[model samples]
Target: MDPHRLLIFREVARTESIAAAARRLGWTQPAVSQHLRRLERQAGLPLVVRHSRGIRLTEAGATLLRHADAIATRLHAAEDDMAALADLAAGTVRLAAFPSACATLVPTAMTNLARHRPGLEIRMTQCEPPAATTLVTSGEADLAVLFSHDSRLPDHGPDLQLIPLTDDPVRLVVPTGHPAATAAAPLTCLASTPWIAGCPSCATHLAHTCEAAGFSPDVQHSTDDYVVVQNLVARGLGVALLPQLALDAYHHPDVRALPLATTERALYLLCHREALQIPAVAETVRALQQAATAHRPQTPPAT
Candidate 1:
């Protein structure tokens, strides 16, 4: 089968729609359909079935897709190898990171790397942990910055390496002048309070933390944006638990942050183990580590 046809078929299989694949590839629908037809003919079987919803891959298509994924991975590795040959002086370092990290750490690191290696190019995309991991493992991104509360989050693959960046504490956010703002407020103290939670994972973590404190939070709002969560708290709609990095990035003056004694999220940097040999990747890792260290909040001296 033609490599080009195989890639086109793979895209179609991924999106489950010829039009969507064409849109992604910047081609017309007819072009994508034609390519799929050619690929199916070469394989000597029907690859997809059309329905009102979209398309579903046939058994043959599924079988071919498996090989296509492997080929794509190999091709991506080849591209990375060739780029590595260019050394640190030139080539792109693609990065995928969650919003909080992007807002806090990425800019400083990018600026530092740019000054150190003017010829190096950096590209970044904001993504959640799972998507960022996928981008790194699929070779779409050279590195990924992610966070998790669980200490034992699984690695993407055997060849992938994860570096712990920092443990960012979770802080309780309350409207300015609220009773909890000036005093030490434990998780149990906020049990009956209406709360604005972060994303699903963050909400789960918050719930677990509250449960461990012997109470369940009355979650009144749910959103992925930290700023929005803070605003909600500021408006006296609810309270929230926000990551330290996010608070550092954008602190709402209308709200106050109180440190939580029992909750924190672990930040991490992910990349292929072999990619470290490349000068650009090594330099980027260094820059990221420096940024992470600089951004980490210092603990107050014990009284």
Candidate 2:
């Protein structure tokens, strides 16, 4: 099948209108229609039906849409792999990471990559944890750095692969002057205190932790900005539940982070299963694992 025709058909099916697909693809409407017709002829089936306002996929079209998406994803990965090989001394590795992970883990990972694989280019974007998996699965990023609480894991699509990087404990952050800051007690003791939260996924993790402690936390503020969240806590607005990573990277004089009695979160490296086979990706993964191993905390000898 013609790749161009399959691409056009995929776009038309996604938009449910030839005009919209043409606009998206930067092609004239007639051109899009012709591509769709050729695709249908190659498949020997009626792929689409005209609707009063747009178009609807026939049964055969729906089946082919799934295959088209997979094919497009693989083709893009192949191109990226080829480009990386062509310029082994200099090629980009696109990455998506959560805000806290970006600040704490990614800096070290990138530094390691630079020292060891200086030829490998690194590009990173801060994304909400929920969206990180999608970015990798859809081929928008070559790799994703993501985190999951002990109670909940982020869902990457089945075709995506995960590699464990670090298992860090979650901590509670409060204003230094707050009574809870000095107390050596379980997180449940602060349930009634107003809490600042990260994005929805982080909030869910906090909620789960609180539930295990036998009460739902009173969330007073929520934001995707890690710096803003720390600033809010510093101003005594409320406390927050966060990973040790945030404490390590964004510590403030007014904010104190306490280890939670129970709960640890896992940070992971995610990529499409198909992309993992690429040589550049494999080398990058090795660099990341080495970075993680070197940075992992060592247990002190018991007295």
**Maximum-lDDT candidate:** 1
lDDT score for residue 242 of model 1:
87
Write model 1 residue lDDT over 206-275, tens digit each, in one string. 8888888798899878899999998898898999888888888898889888876757889889999988
Candidate with the greatest TM-score versus the true structure: 1
Error of 1 at 232 (Å): 0.6
lDDT of 2 by residue, 1-303 (tens): 998788889999999999999999999999999889988999999999998889999999999999999989999988887776755555678889887777867788788778766778778999876687788877889998888776455687788888888887777777776777556664756878888888776888889888887888899898866578778989988888767666666677777777666577888899988877776677777777776677565641110
- Candidate 2 achieves a global lDDT of 0.79
* Candidate 1 accuracy as lDDT: 0.86
Candidate 2 similarity to native, TM-score: 0.66
Pairs of residues at least 3 apart in sequence or in different chains that clash in candidate 1: none
Error of 2 at 125 (Å): 1.7
Off by over 4 Å in 1: 1-87, 182-185, 300-303
